[model samples]
Target: MKKSSKDSVVTAAILLFNSKGYSGTSIRDIADAAKVNTATIAYYFGNKEGLLEYCFTYFFEQYINKMEASFATIEKGAAICLKRVVADLLHYQWENIQLASFVYREMSIDSQMVREIMATYSLKEKYYLQKIFERGFEWNEFRPHSIPYLIIQLKGLLMMPFMNTHYMREVLYVFPNEKFFEQKYLKDLYQWIDKTLCSDIQIKKEAIIK
Candidate 1:
């Protein structure tokens, strides 16, 4: 699909902002990369800050929708649902590593704009995750744990690798840019989730039988 001019600008802005900090990137740079006039950016996004918000919103919307879609046909149980959600999220983050890195970098700075974006979209993401956890608990698929802690741990698991992609690539010899690395990482992540979150219902049943 041909990207719309607005999308083109936002895509260019993500790459530029990821490479160069927000303050370091200029509207002209985005315009040149996107092959649009500077005025087009101002017209579409009003300003650089607005463009940043739009970029966050665009990518996050895509993430949330994909997550929701992953759950659509999942009637098996919370374990299956959680597994699919985690897998989809990991794949999405890998696919949009630049955006993930940019968001993580901005989050570390704690700028007013970043805080605002977090307050808005991140809350929604948290809520969705909370619902998933709630379902897991209700279905007895997960052991009882602090919901906030679980959320934090899950977010850390998902974001840490991508946020530290450079370090992983350079120091750890983990080439996240390669398909094989992501596949292996995702497989291990799934195993970790199962071990950490999955309730030992069979064990409990065996104990009851005894």
Candidate 2:
């Protein structure tokens, strides 16, 4: 990648945001971590809050783009749509645990920032899953209940492992690290979700095929 001031600031911001938080991290800290002068952060990002906003946008933009690509490839019917989306999502969080942690951390501390990010992306891909769920519901694809809650529960299944790292590292000794994203886990996870929600239903798994 070409070296640039914006790249430097973003890299530093993500690292510091992962280690420190939005409030805990400062412009000086990011500058120092990036080996640039504090003025560079100000020049590039305008200020600390500006830097935080940039970091939030940077993280979720990358996420949305990646998810868009994954969903584009494997979105069709309800069952396969959920499976593929969830599988790709699991692989993404497993690969970029920092991104997920950074998002969860920021959302935990300040929900407004998270809401802003979601709102920004929602018009595009953020709320697209709701469309998928609505389509599935119309087709009698999902369980006969709150489809939104089920969708969020599926997201929770992916988020819990990463957000609760300390507990996993200490107690469960089972971390959702690199190797966990392999075909074995993803296949089983997809299968479990498939059976859990699709077994009794008549809707065929045409999402991935389509």
Candidate 3:
């Protein structure tokens, strides 16, 4: 399907912002990348800040929808749900690395646009994770701990791989753009989640018995 002009602009903006950052990227850069005039971006999105806000909002809206769909189809168990959530998160981050990168960069700064996006979408994202954690607690699939801390850890796990791509390429010589690196990273992530957060077989059995 042919992408709309606005969609094209947003896609271009994501890449530019991810690579050059919010302050470094310009409206002309996005326009040139999108093969459209600057007025086109202005038409679709009022300004640079407006475009950034729309980009984040659109990304999270799609993310939430996908998460909801995954939750709906997955088996009714906390362990199963947790695994699916982690898998989905990993896949999404990998597929949308540019948007993920842009978001990670924006998160570190203090800006009204960032604040609004966080309050509007980031909080909702946190709530979804919290619900999963709550379910795990009730099912005894996860041990008791601070929900906020767990959320932070989970977000960090998901974001770190994409955020540290340069380090991975330079220090570890792992090119994330390669399928080999992506698969290996994802496998390691799954193992980390299983080891750190999941209940052992005996614990699950005891919980069931009780």
**C-alpha RMSD between model 1 and the true structure:** 3.6
Worst 10 residues of 1 by lDDT: 201-210
TM-score of 3: 0.86
Instruction: For model 3, give the RMSD to the true fold.
Output: 3.3
lDDT of 1 by residue, 28-66 (tens): 999999999999999999999889887777777888887
Error of 3 at 27 (Å): 1.8
Find the 10 residues in a row with the least total lDDT in model 3. Answer: 73-82
Per-residue lDDT of model 3, residues 78-168, tens digit only: 6576667777877787788778767777778888877877897788778777888787777677777789998888888778877867886
lDDT of 2 by residue, 1-210 (tens): 777977877877777887777678887888888889988888887898888787668767876776676566434565566666777777777777766777766766647777776678745654657666666667777665565676577667767777866676789777667595355567777765666566345344445445
In candidate 1, list every pair of residues with a backbone clash: none
TM per model? 0.86, 0.79, 0.86
Per-candidate Cα RMSD to the true structure, in Å, reads 3.6, 3.5, 3.3
What local lDDT does model 1 show for residue 117? 66
